[model samples]
Target: MRITVGKWFQGGSPWVWLNAGAVAISLVMVVGLLALIAVRGLGHFWPSAIVAADYRVPGQESRQVLGQLADSETVSGERLRGAGLPLDPSLDVVERSLIKVGNRDVTGSDFAWVVEPWLQDAHYPENVMAVERREWGNFYGYLKAVREADKTVATGDQAWEVFQQRIARALAIHDQIYQIEKHDIGSINARLERLRLKERGLELKGNATPAVLAGIQAERAALDAEYKVLEQQLGKLYVAFNRDSAVAETADGQEVILSMGKVVRAYQPNAMGLVDKLAFYGDKLWEFVSDDPREANTEGGIFPAIFGTVMMVILMSIIVTPFGVIAAVYLREYAGQGFMTRSIRIAVNNLAGVPSIVYGVFGLGFFVYFLGGQMDQLFFPAALPAPTFGTPGLMWAAITLALLTLPVVIVATEEGLSRIPRSVREGSLALGATKAETLWRVVLPMASPAMMTGLILAVARAAGEVAPLMLVGVVKLAPSLPLDGNYPFLHLDQKFMHLGFHIYDVGFQSPNVEAARPLVYATALLLVIVIAVLNLSAVAIRNSLREKYKTLEV
Candidate 1:
């Protein structure tokens, strides 16, 4: 039996199969892309053996090089020769490997591409040290000796054991220093600034009388005394932190002295067993997520970015939901079904199609320049020269995103409201319920699932948006989170970090492209996971709402 194409289309089987094929292809592509990103990004944290090899290219000197093999690729000789490199005419293809030669101060670059044909006698040495740093990225070399100032503490075979011990002590001290500076002293500094602002405000109000001044002075004195104690402790810590230095020799045999506090952690990747390597990898991954970024944000963790992203999304959701729901209820329940209402609905639908960057521009001009400026002029007169709300910060970012996604919420809610049977509303009215009561009690409950759906879509769109955030509140590095332990714990006026902006900054604005590429993928993967989590939470709520209202709707 020959099945004609028209007959198959008429039977709807062709359309069903066609849709299934499209969905399958989409899933495969999305999964494949995510897998690729995961492999490239997550694999960067894993410990790889550092290869020490003598590399020579034709007439070049045979100098030894040491680095982790970063990547490999095949290149046609024609392409190589086009770039002014001499290659054999007979060579059709040549394999090359990129080695992450990580002594940046010594080599001036973290990576170097070496032709595979020119490398010889490659081996992994157990004694080679890979030192993760607080400043210079990573240092890969052989530890020559352990020293304190000019005095050599340990050398020869004893250097490794002694180096390990002193490094552990140095790291412990570094942690203490970090805690005091960032948390303890940081809190003090914040309080001191608040006190200064308070004094300024009092003086402006003509209330800085002698007694008030005296009381403020007394408080300042107490804070100063406390600061001095913290300062002395910090001074002692710095002395301890910088006292221990290790002498390491690069593959080129030049000795480099690295201060102990500068080193984050050091290990011999080449000598680690599978279990040890896995442990190290786990530790590094945790640090990446939990630690604050250092070294121009190419290294370390992204906790600040994560926190800011989630906070902004939540704030946006809070601001948008009520406004959207109210508008939708009025339009669907109370508004006359006339030309004017239809026009307003069309305008709202059109808003969903507006470019995101346009919203960013509108936010910057209206919210930041106009509204924020007025706020600073009115409420923050003492802080005139330095703008308070008259700057891009968390609140404005949230508000801007709320406005951008309002249309989506309104449309979803209206559709949900329309889906509720007129009979239900009539029944409520017939039961002597007021119109407001029907909307509040009966109408909204059925439409709650649709509101959740809108929120999920809104979050998915807003979470990944970078352009608007860049203009409003997103920054490469935020010194403090929007919410903190300070009074008015949720500091809505503070500028914030964001994962989407971090991806953009790392991928494009970073000084080192090759080094930042993996970070980009990792950050991208993190963003996808965050959006998924948010959507799943909304979905769970939506499912529960649907279940609860199922009988009511029927």
Candidate 2:
């Protein structure tokens, strides 16, 4: 089957095959990574259990019958049975008795054995049993029931009535407590305000009369005493809220049932149960999306890292875009061809290749220590002892990333400026446009797509960066947001958390690694999505601009 072929295709084909192989390998690597991430991240949301039950059925049966029923005497049709009197045609006798089934460890009991009359028609008959033999099913349900029953026996309407009455009484007590505390605080504040006013009056009169001064001093002392009492009372209320007795109420006006201890115990089993495990992870994922910045880690949600990451990226973009574009414009269009310009171009390219960690160190030294120190010495002598600019903060992090990604923007923008046809510039100059005017209107609009592309790359790089930000501004945990109620509220000097740092911290540095693994994967997925969205948006803008200017022939 040999056939003649062209000389070019007949020999030295190994290089072509090698190039194809390399491309295939790269595609496999990228696709494999995406597949792995998608599987692990999405698997967390899938249901992992067969059955779930809370064991708090409102209409639970109080009685349970065990053992088989006794046989009944049967009637014969006009015939006598051996060793007995003649059987009647219509007479019949049955034996029945009530019995109690003792509680047992039915972990291995069959589904049929644990079935009660009410549970026979359950959707998942195997899962709805009161006592599960298998450890795989929702064991936590049974445990919760056991714990809840120990705390309270009433069920259904009876339980609801008891709960309502208790809540009402607790509310009444809380209202009384709040009113008393408010009145005491108000009185103390009023007295303090009056004392301050009197002192001002004395100053205005230019007469520090002994009686007036004494009156002011006495009022101040009284206000302090009252405030102390109010604080003490408030402390007591806080203690009460923490204690079980605060929510406890007597069913018969004689015996109080304390629920705080019981409720906490009951919650433990439910938390350990399979259904609760699913719910817990679900909530964790939800928290990653919906959490507000005000919540702490202990409160089940927080979004400070998300907010800080966005703010830092925006600040970096603002600082880098203009500087990079201008530098690119100067290098590509204005700068004459010379050894000096060529050398500078090489240096700028090399800067982009430098390790980000090194940039972080440079930023810490130059921006934080040198520039910040100079500013502090020149402008803030009264606040001299405290360091402001020298501290690691949001501003420093942004500036550091801006520098790190500057070369990328510069290279991209320069390529864009180079792409515009030479005739366009000649025509602008022919029309009496100056160099600045050409750059501003004609050159910039044409080069915008390239600039946007550079900005997109810079943003993508800066957003995922963890190591540099860690050294410069990112904190493991930030107590307050960078923007707050303080004077000149947007405090760039304040340290902030980032999602990338959070991923690193929770994955490697967490106290409970096993418990935090899912959270780590979820956070990593979120970071990827955020970066992808930012890049996609920039790409869209670039495309839109390209389409708008498509009709303008080069």
Candidate 3:
């Protein structure tokens, strides 16, 4: 029981405690970061009570303001005075707040900073309404009246009900118009482009006969007729789109008319109960994930980005797995333990440490420019000069990521192979099985869990990569997904949106900083969740494989 300090140090208890302490610290930091992101991001969906206040700054007239309180900070009085604000000499610190006054079209600003002491008569009015628009950010005001064209349809207390009904009608019409334009007309446009390509392709090969030309012309004419019908329907829908308008009185008491067709939704946060707020929050959260982005990606859903991120990761996994496994097998089972093989293994390990951006540059140069350009010239000469495959797209992005993650897979697979008892392989060969047969049936199956582990690591790394994707395929906004209902459904040559890239664009490239900030947090959280789900799925498969082959290992 009387152990000396030197004896205790020799026992290694301190090192064990040190390692556990380090792990605990790391876990706390990770959990704390995720908690912060969830709070800041998910809190954006909950409706906050809009405050109406009379604010007056030094050397300015007092004006009525209506908006949500976004954030607050304490600053030195000296700093405030340096910014030309008059403050008491005795004051050491002052509190300032950022308000999201969302009449961007009228006031020409999305937010305004006010000194807390100068804010007078701050209150939440039940009559105040927050309108989510398809354009111009958000509109905060009081409902004045509902009008159909120049005629007043409803006024006073009934205008809110009438406005809601008209908004529902407008949204329904919008959905119909969206279907016609994006789906039906989009399909026709794609077909027409293909026909043009076909004609050009024939001309290049000196095979454009009169009958062939006439057939192409006939197809074009049929598409034109269909387009014309959709065009007429769209013309009528446009007329309906702007049919109803709502008159609203702003915080400044100026009346502005907003088309019901342009309104996404309207809410009175001051009047909403907990249940109503929860419903509103759910709707907003769904829209953030399912709807198309609007207002320069500061508003709307990131469904396209989500689709592209998942699609590219799946493709990368498919490309990297087999190649990694083969290379690992060759090195571990067949290749001699020579200097050249040792050099190669060292090189492979070094490659994993190389900066990811360098891989992106290599991918852009080799995969996109060299190989894709050659393919375009040799196999798709018709699409030449336009550079179909030669451009940055989905295929190149996937290949680039696959190349980036190959080292991880090879190392993991090799380790797994090294773990398989040599006696097992010897037994398989002794039991009337050839070397190839032993590898195919016994070795590979037992080694599968390792391949899955490699794949899981690859997915974890590839899904979060933004720089390489930016150079190869990721775009700010993709008009349509790489996948569609067209022939040869998955178009790997198309550029696509990505969640990581979207977060970058919205967080840094957006003009509306305040509006984009919360969205950045929310999108980042979603990206983490996506990577987690992918890794967890891979992990589940890996565990299952391990269980199935556990007896083989014994």
Candidate 4:
């Protein structure tokens, strides 16, 4: 029998095809976006050959320009002329390249766009060095001499090798200084502060005795002594760190001296072979994930943000899962399915659609001010005026996200619970199991996969949220991680960084727009990868649960 087009319409085949096409289009768009992000982000670390050229433009003197070619585009000649550039009226289009000039201290700008037609004698110089600095961005120049205490130690043919050796030594010293300052001395300072608070508490309680006071003073003295010793060690390390410097001639023939202590890494991209470039690229990629931000968060790694994001998501899962499951169980198994129950379900569904910033406002007002303030007054009176839990921190951020995602978990779990056969429950109750036992041992195991599905959904939403976190706990830069080697291993009261906010800060709030653009893409890609890993892990567990209960459902 021939199938007519009108019959196909009645049979819903067209709708099926339409839905499949829509799904295919969505998947393609998501994949294409990921590919674009990866290309723009990962390509930033690869070493590009530095180009030396003389930029000649109409009505302006030609000057030496040195930097990496960042991007290129074709624009109308009229646009170029409107920007005060004297372009030929006969030409319809003009080609230009955006160059990363790097010497921000000298030029006051990190990037510039120049017309390609006026670029003369463009070439790569093998001796040209790109110095990644701890501040003020990168410096591009030619190696001149390596200095030790204002005296030239290596010059001419051997300066590069000597400079590299000294830089490596300086970096080692810097690491030691970091450890001493941020960890050892930091621990002592924290302990000393605790002792001070303890002493004050004793005094406030009218319990200040000579014996207790003596003990506190003794501990404080010991910590102070330790701090003094670390301070002396840091002093010596600083002296050694500042011992070496390098002189280089810029593209414009200006000689500049860069301190070895301020340099992060220096390399000649033009002189590198393919293997060398690959190794360099790998190192930079690792640094982006492991190092701390420098130069107003435009340079270096974002490990803190990554750590905070994962920690917050894990905490939110821990908080939301049990509460959501309990609520779901009560609604599905115990509650009378009447008007009140339906009303609550409707309210929950509506909550899922509430603006996220409203949650942030609620978290700040109730959680931070009311609940946390009560906690501080009840438990930590010695730290009065200086709020502990009374301010925004990690704990509040986690709780706020959990509250935001509770509706998702409840809806998903209820659906899972609804799917179980009534016969299954009757059989359990008939077999000498109580109602609670059947619900706990039989029903819950079969529905475990659904609980995990809800958790996965919650994590997917919580990880990328920036607004609520910004109000509750997230900061531009957290000097210390919420989880650290302190006495309380996990300080729930401490503020922390987040990858989503990092992307926002770097992308929109940065002063150096051109330098921050690539970092924004890289951080965004990392956030996506983090979310994917969390979802995949939950999915794996859900699949395992589903397999384990496959026969039980039957």
Candidate 5:
């Protein structure tokens, strides 16, 4: 048996099996992790039933609790007693539930923990509504009435219908207001700023004449006229939207009037059938991916973060590929394989192992501070003190990440170039092709797939990096996207949001921990999906290239 095992090891069969097992284990773990995240995160958007129950804690007042049951657990009775809660000596364990009692404006918190023994008369009422708001997370209450500027337009069950109709109107009006303010007014602001820069440029050149000044003034007047018209339209819409309100009664019988404009969506989760809940889930998921974040990023969506992440990765790929390829070509194709070349390779390998935060620090000092400051002084002297390019923004961030992942690309490209047969290069050179021409057509085409492999790895790393981005550019909330309906639409100097940083901020930095936890899981899963999709795209391109050039290999 020992001889047989030794022979197996010598044949490399055992090692192959061991390596396959390791890869299998890794694949299983990755799938399991993604499954866990999807279950925890995607489940959050499904409309859960709201329960109204009576609770009586020992030596405390008998009161009503109304909320969604968020979680449940069984704990030792001794722990409860140790925490100063009165408990029976005979009871070894007790069950408790965490309920999402979301009337934060009134209760000061969005969640409550209620012991099962003290809870009674639990019921799911069809009229119970879950209100997603703009300011205070979520509101759970019974719709009592719907009003139009003090006059009750809907009462009891009828109010529910009225509420939905008017809220839809309010949302439409709000969208219009958003477009005008962000798109139209935003354009005017950009034009005005450009005019200021132009004036400053002319002044610097000693050419600030009266006629030139008059032209700038005339353009300003035209923009202001448009702004006034949009402003007046916005004011009227605001009045129209604010005219409607709803009076909702809490479980404690306290009635409060809420504006329709503040509510994002209202749904009766308990009353919704499986089909209804599924539809609601789909809509919520779409909104989460398609809309901008609101309420300190704890409430609405993360479309901006998604857009910023993809945009940054593309920009990084574009900036890094050429530089990395050129470096690799020089080292592998032209330079002699001597001690210096070996030392440079060792340095690049060491760079890959350096901590990511070190790259962030370097980017801040070198890219944002040094190079940007010089560019600002030379080209944008007119916009001084404000620090245009001298600030953390999109272009600097892309360049910083390019530098951070440069080693990976260089290594991959070098490997690919090394794999190409030397005889192929000789054959091309002997057939009337110069060395440069042979490299550009024969070698490069065959090696294009390897360059893509490097890009795939670089993109996978860059998309998930949050540290370097924090210093170079990612923000918690970017009011405007880097690209918009403005001049030079792709504004490389604008600050942007990132999905990885969004996850970090919501998961750790948020003030509302319990409320943010679900979002954290959801955002994390989304980030993973985004990276996977990006990798798959690059992989597809690489596969196509490899297939096309397969005949050249033999």
Candidate 6:
């Protein structure tokens, strides 16, 4: 012990040091990737601007600028009104003015204006205010303002105002329609019920019921005729309300038609006032999450994607856990050693190695075609040719992923089950517990930590998966959420958007590759962060369970 240091140095090995260094480097790479994703993905939630062409008269040009408008202040004899503040006339009064282009006025007029700061490398006519600087509440506030403006223009001020009034009217109308529809539905149901009852009655009588059957047939015909009329009326109302129309008035009080683009520009955010920049970003970030989907990119928010991801993961977990656990239990507790068990083990291990794209093919063929086709035929006869189950949807995607990750969960759970001391099972049985009771109450609980570890691994894999989901359910754009207002509203057969596929589409399929590259990175970062968060949560749960079961240590 006194002289061991010199002998150890003489027998030094470089391989050990090299191995340690490699491990350190690997850890650093992983941590760096995580940091990059968190920073970049979170950054996109903040506000940024895109410069586009401004085309109009040589003296008057129009450009699109995004940001919120500054608060309005009215000057009254050297005092500011509307903002509850007194004006300092001596302080530089920055008066913002927009030229009346094509008979458009600043007040009560929706005209597109580009902020001064956003103008770069673009020529502006001598008379045109190509760039102007104004204050907006935040990026999201700016977006909201634009949306309101778009709606106002598309329907015409009078019409749009009328439409707003009509939205309430529409709700009332909807209720009325629902009542009428309900009545019709009830009538149809009653007729069908009567037909069924008469059929049953005729069977009981057994003597003959041509008259009763004829009466039933007449009732059916009347119901069908009434339903057709109601359907036609409903269709007409839907069309009348759904048509897009906008009104714009010229400076001379002449009105003209406007497109969604025109109205959006006219109603763009007014940036006239400045406030705290940090608060602006913070507010904008919140808005990004809360806003509605826009026409092209669905500008209001990413809420749908967030919702979809959470829903898919939860569903996939629900599907995978029981199946994986049960498989593990059977292999560990019930299955006897033999060629069959060994073959089953090999198949499970091989399943983990198969490329996920293959699973997509399997999902599309089996789940989307075979199983779904059978379901559609058996239950949804009225929805014929629509292929409810045959379409790519969240349910199928979840099931596909559950299958894809099943092997991992099974292997991990089996390992965990194997590690539990046999004595625990024996003890439970000795205390008068049945095999099922011992497994469920004692063995399963003891193995839960390991099971969770497997689940965490599965979640991380599934959360980042894009290949299978693409074939099964992921869409480039979805107009409405999977869960919405309709009969059996949570339509699992409908295609849905996913962050992983969004990254792929933006990176590869986008028209503006350069513009979308940053977005791709941002999305990738988001996916990584989501997976990390899930894994971290699982880790926390595992730690808690481990602590709870610490006394059961082998």
- TM agreement with the true structure for every prediction: 0.97, 0.62, 0.99, 0.98, 0.98, 0.62
C-alpha lDDT values of all predictions: 0.91, 0.63, 0.94, 0.94, 0.92, 0.63
- The TM-score between candidate 6 and the true structure equals 0.62
Misplaced by over 4 Å in model 2 are 1-28, 45-284, 292-299, 552-554
Question: Which regions in candidate 4 have their CA more than 4 angstroms from the true location?
Answer: 1-3
TM-score, prediction 1:
0.97
Q: Between candidates 3 and 5, which one is better according to lDDT?
A: 3
Error of 1 at 127 (Å): 1.3
Tens digit of per-residue lDDT, candidate 4, span 295-365: 88999999999999999999999999999999999999999999999999999999999988899999999
**Worst 10-residue lDDT window, candidate 2:** 129-138
Score candidate 3 by lDDT.
Answer: 0.94
Question: Better model by TM-score, 3 or 6?
Answer: 3
Residue-wise lDDT of candidate 1 within 365-483, one digit each (tens)? 99999999999888987777799998999999999999999999999999999899999999999999999999899999889999998899899999999889989998999998888
Per-residue error for 21 in candidate 1, Å, reads: 0.5
Worst 10 residues of 4 by lDDT: 1-10
Query: Model 4: clashing residue pairs?
Result: none
Candidate 3 wrong stretches, greater than 4 Å: none
Report the Cα lDDT for residue 314, model 4.
94
For model 6, residues 459-508, the per-residue Cα lDDT tens digits are 98998899999899988877567775454557677778787877777678
Output the lDDT of residue 530, model 3: 96
